[model samples]
Target: MAGHSKWANIQHRKGRQDAKRGKIFTKLIKEITVAAKMGGGDASTNPRLRLAIEKAKGQSLPKDNIDNAIKRGTGQLEGVVYEEVRYEGYGIGGAAVMVDCLTDNKTRTVADVRHAFNKNGGNMGAEGSVAFQFKHCGQMIFAPGTDEARLMDAAIEAGAEDVVTNDDGSIEVITPPNDLATVLEGLEAAGFKAEFAEVVQKPLNESVIGGDDAMKMQKLLDALESLDDVQEVYTSAVIDE
Candidate 1:
C-alpha cells in the first residue's frame, strides 16, 4: 500500500470537484431522479432515494431543483430516462479502474468511456475484470491527529465493522453500506465528525504508481470523470499527491 493516503486522495478529489461544481450538480440530479424513479419519491420509505437526496443536499442543490428532479423521476414531470452502466479498465502501470455511469444512450456512453481509456494510456476491460479487486463498503475517514481511542470506541459501539489507523495517522472506519447513515449519525452524536464519508468500492490492494505513470493515470481518471454520463470512478492506483 505504498503511496496510499486516503486523506490526501480525498482532498485532491474534493479540490477537483469544487472546480467542477456545475458538472457535479448534473450528476447529483441524475442520481436523485433515477433513485426516485426506481424506488419512489418518498425518501422515508426508499433508502436509495433517501441517500440520493442526502447527497444532493450535501452539495447545496436548490430545494426547488431537488423537488423537480423527484417529480421527473416519479413521472409527474418529463425527464430523460437513464440506465446505470459500469465500465472496467486498466490505467497506466496496470492500475485497476472502474467507471459507473447513468446514461440514456449506452452506445454513446461506452464509446466516450473507451475513448477516455484508450487515449490516456489505459485500456478497457470486460465486466468484472477489475471489479474483484475492490469491495463494496461504507467508509468514514477522520483526519490525521484525531482522537483514535475515542473514535474507535464510538464506531464499534455504533456497529462499525473495522477501524484502521493509516500510517499517516488518519483513521478509517469501515461499516456495512446499509449502516452508513446510522453509524455516521451515531459518531456525530458522540462529537466525532469524519472528513470524508461514502459507500465506495474500497480497493483490496494498491497499485503504486509514481513519476510519469502517476501523471498519466491521473489524466485517464480525470478524463473519465469529466464525461457527463459518468457518475463515479474508482481506482486501485495509489500515488502521493
Candidate 2:
C-alpha cells in the first residue's frame, strides 16, 4: 500500500515554509511548460497537458500564471529551454535514491545535485547504479475515508493494475502510465480525492532505515528537493509511525 507514506504528505504535515512553496511552484510551472510544449496547449486535445493543468489548478495557482506557462511552452511567448534530468544514488544504509530535475543548464544542475548528495553524507552514482532497484509505476494515493469497495471496483474498471490499501485507511491505486489519467478521473467521478497522483519510481522491495539513519536520509532528500532545478525525489526509505 502507498499509504500516507508519500513524501508530499510528510512535507505538508511538516508545514513547508514560504521558500518551499516557491520551490514547488517553480517545479509546477516547469511541468506545465514542458507538458504544453510536448503536447499542444489545448488541454481537451492533449492528455498530458490536461493532467499538468489539473495539477496546477489543484495547487491553487492563478489562472493567468497557468496560461502564461502554456503560452511560453507553445512558443507564443519565449521561456527558458529547460532540460529534464535524473540522478541515481544511495542514502544511508544503502537506501536507493532517485532525483528528478528540470534545468536550463545540465552542467550547473549536475554540480548542485552532486554537492547536495555529498553534503548530506550521501554520494551520487552513475546511471543505473540504483535505478535497478525501482520500477516506474503510476501511483495514485487515495484520500482518507474513501469507500474501499467502490474504489476497488472503480479502479479495476478504470484499468488499474492493482489497488492496495493499508490498515490506516490509505489506499494506493496503481496503473500503467497510459492509464493514470483514466484511473484518476474514474476515482474522482466516484467522489474520491487523491492524496498523491503522479508517475513514481516505486521500489520493487522496500528497505527500512529509521532513527538516525532515517534522519540523515531525509536531510539528503530535503537538500535535493530544495534545489531549484529539482522536480522530484524518490527513495526506498521507509516511513511508518
Candidate 3:
C-alpha cells in the first residue's frame, strides 16, 4: 500500500479514541470558523464552509457548537481572529512533513512546532522545501468491505479523477478540490459512505521507514497534532502497521 493510504488507515483507527476526540473537535471547529470567516457563514454558498461543516457533522460535533462557530465567524459573536500558517519540515528517514495551523499568535505556534520537530528526531525546513512533493486534492476513503465496483462507477460518473484500491482492501477516490462536495453528494446518493474524506496535501512519493526511525516519526506527528494551534499534519513516511 502507498504511504498516505497506510497513514490514513492508522489515523482512521486513532480518530475513534475517546482521548483524541476533544482535540479533533477543536481542530474541526477551527476549520469551520476559518472557512466561515473567509467565505461567509452560508454553507450553501461557501464551498469551504460546506466541506468543513460536513466534516464536523461526520465527527458528530454538536449542532449548537456548529451554530455558535458560524456566528463567531460572521461577527455576530466575538471571537479571536486566527491566521492560517503552514510549516514544512523533514521527519525521520527524510520523510517530508507539512503542518497546518490556525493561530492568533504565530510566534508561539511556530516555536511549538519547531520544538516538536527538533525533539522528535526531525528538522524544520524552509518554506516550499517539501510542499512540491505533495498534491492538493479531495480524497475519500471507503472501508475494506465496500463494494469496489459500485464505488468506482459512482465516483467516475461524479467526475472523480482516480480510484485506488489499497493493499489493505480500502478504496480511495480522488477528485479535484473544488469538486469535493459534488462528488461526496453523488457518492452518498449512490449509497456509498466514506470512512474518511477530506481535501488533503497528498504526497507524490513515499519514504519507507521502520524500527526506531518509524517510532520517532510517529512521535513527531503526534506532538505536532497535540499542539492547540496545529490543525493537521501530513507526511510522506510509511511506517510498519
Candidate 4:
C-alpha cells in the first residue's frame, strides 16, 4: 500500500513486510512473471524486468524461483496465464483509491475487489472515476537529512522529472515511469540511495483524514491489499502515522 501525505515510515513499513513475507513473495513472483512476459526475459534489455528482479532480490526471493518465473513468462515453462486489472474506489472521507491486480480469473478478481471495498467503508468506482486525480510516474524516496543539494544535481543529470523536499524533510524524486531504473542507477552511483523506489500511481494532492476516519481508511486499504490478486494499492488518503 502507498500513500501520498504522511506515508508510513520506512522502517515501520519494512517491519510490516517482514511480518507478511509470505504474501509479499507471492506478489513479487507475480510481478516478475508479468514483467518478464510483457518485456521479454532478458533483464539487461528490459527495464521493467530489471526493476522487478531488483525488487525480488531486495525481498530475498530465491534465485530458482526468479529463474522459473522468468522462464514461465517467456513460455519456456507452463504457468498460469494472467491478465492485468485495475479498480478504483473511494475510501473513508471519500479519499480516492486504486488497486492494481494480476489474475488468471477476472471474474474472481473483480468480485474480491468489490467485496473488499463494500465491506470496508469504501465504495467501488467505475473506470476513470478517480484516475484523473493521480499521475502515473516513477517515485524514489530518500530518508531525511540527506544532502539535498547533491541529490538534486544528480537527479537532474539522471533525467528525473522533479525533486521535491517534503515538510518532514524526506526527499522525493520523480521520473517518467520508463526512466525509473536509469534514474535509480544514476542516483545510487552518485551516492544518493532511495529507501523506496517504484513506478506508482502518485496522488496529485492528498486528502488528510485523521482520528477515527484515519483508522477506517487504513482498514479499507489493508482489506484491498490483502486480496490475493491485488499487486498494489494506492490511495490519496493521508492519515496520521
Candidate 5:
C-alpha cells in the first residue's frame, strides 16, 4: 500500500493542469464527446460519459461547452478524432515517468513529447521500459470534510485498499484496479463526493530526490504535462519540496 509517497509531486501536477483552463475544457470536452458518441449522452446510462461530465463539473466548465463537446463526439457537430497514446520515461533522480496522451497525430505527438523531455533534462524511454515500474489502480479524491473513521469503514467495505492525505490537504482513496468503479459507486451511494476519480498508474517505489535534482524533476514533469496532447503524467519521485 505504500511503495511510493509522491503526494506533493502529484498535487503540483494537478495545479498546472488546472491553470490551463481552456485546455482542460478541450480535453474534457473531447472525452465527453467520445463517451457520449460511443455510449449515448445520458450520464446515468453511460458510465464513461457520466464520469466525463462529472469531471467537467468539478472544473466548473460551462454547461454549453459540455453540451457542444458531446455533440461533436456524437457527430451532430464537427470534431477531430483523437487517439490514445502512452509514453514512458525517466525524469530527474532517475525516477520513472508515465505520460498518457490523446492526440490526432501520432508522429507529431511523439516528437513533441521527446522534445519536452530533452528540453527539461529527461529522456523518453522505449516502450515497456519505465512502464513496468508502475501498476494500474483505481484512485479517487474525497472532500476534506469526510469523517476519517466513517470513510475508512465504508471504504473497507467497498474494497478500498488505502486512504492517505495529500500535502495540500486533500485525501486520496485507493482501490484495487478491478474494484475501482465499484468502490466509487458505493462511496457515491453512501453520500460522499469525490473531486476527481479515475483509474491510473501508481508507482511501486519512489526515487528520493532533493535540491537541484528535485527542481529539474519538477520542471520536466511540468513540461510534459503542459503539452496539449498530454492528458496525465505520473512519476515515482517522492519529493518533499
Candidate 6:
C-alpha cells in the first residue's frame, strides 16, 4: 500500500476530537436524537440508532442523557426537531470536502458553512459537486501494529467488502453502510477491536497535502466542524505528518 498513513490520519482526527470533547457530546446527542426520531428508539431494530448509541457510549455519554435523548426523539419528551443536511465543497489543493449537519434551521447552517468555506480559502459547492468523489460506507481502521494476516482472515469471514493496508501499515476494513454494526460485532468477536470505526463518507481517493495548503485545509475543516449544527466533516485531503 502506498498512500498517506491511515494511522496518522486517525490520530490527527482523534486529537482534534479530543480537544473538543465538550462539543463532541453535543454532536453525539444530536445524532442519537435524530437517529431515534427517524427510525424509532429501538436500537435493535434501527441500525442508525444502534450505531449512534454505540458512538455515544464509546464517548462515555451518561446513561441518563442517552435515555432522555431517545425519549425526546421518540416524542415522549419535547425537543427541537432537526433535519439532516449535507453540504459539499472544495478544500485547499482542490480536495473534496463534505459537511454533514443536523440542523433545525437549514438557512443558518448553509450560511455558516459557506462563510467558513469562504473565510478559509475554500468554496462551498452545490449539492453533489464534491460528493461524487466519496463513497458512503462503513470504515474501521486498526493501528499499525495490528496483525494483518489475522485481520484479513477475520475481515473476510465477517463479510467485509475490502481490506486495505495503508503506507504506514495501518489496516482498514470496508463494509456496506447498512452492514456496519454486524461487521463490527463480528470483528470484535474475533478479537480485532478497531482504533476507529464508523459509517462515513469515505474518500475514494486522497490528495496528499502539505505546507500552507495543509494548514489552510485544517483551518477550513476546523471552522466547519466547530459549527454547532455540523455533525461531521469529511475531506479528501490527507495532510502529511
| Candidate number achieving the greatest lDDT relative to the actual structure | 6
Candidate 5 per-residue C-alpha lDDT over 28-145 given as tens digits, one digit per residue, 9 for 90 to 100: 8777877888888777777678778878888899999999888887788888887778998989867999999888899999999999999999999999998888878888876555
Clashes of 4: 0
TM-score of 3: 0.94
Clashing pairs in 1: none
User: TM-score of predicted model 1?
Assistant: 0.95
Error of 6 at 203 (Å): 0.8
lDDT of each: 0.89, 0.81, 0.87, 0.89, 0.80, 0.92
Segments in model 6 whose C-alpha atoms lie over 4 Å from true places: none
- Model 3 vs truth, CA RMSD: 1.8
Q: What pairs collide in candidate 6? A: none
Please give the TM-score that candidate 6 achieves against the real structure: 0.98
What is candidate 3's lDDT per residue for 170-223, written digit by digit as tens?
A: 888999998888899999999998867889998888777778877787788888
Tens digits of per-residue lDDT for model 1 on 21-76? 99999999999899899989998877677777887888899999999999999999
- RMSD value for candidate 6: 0.9
Of 1 and 2, the candidate ahead on lDDT is 1
Per-residue error for 21 in candidate 5, Å, reads: 1.6
Q: What TM-score against the true fold does each predicted structure earn?
A: 0.95, 0.91, 0.94, 0.96, 0.84, 0.98
- Candidate 4 residue spans exceeding 4 A from truth: 1-11
Residue 5 displacement (Å), model 6: 1.9
- TM-score rank order: 6, 4, 1, 3, 2, 5
Ranking by lDDT: 6, 1, 4, 3, 2, 5
Runs of candidate 1 with Cα error greater than 4 angstroms are 1-3
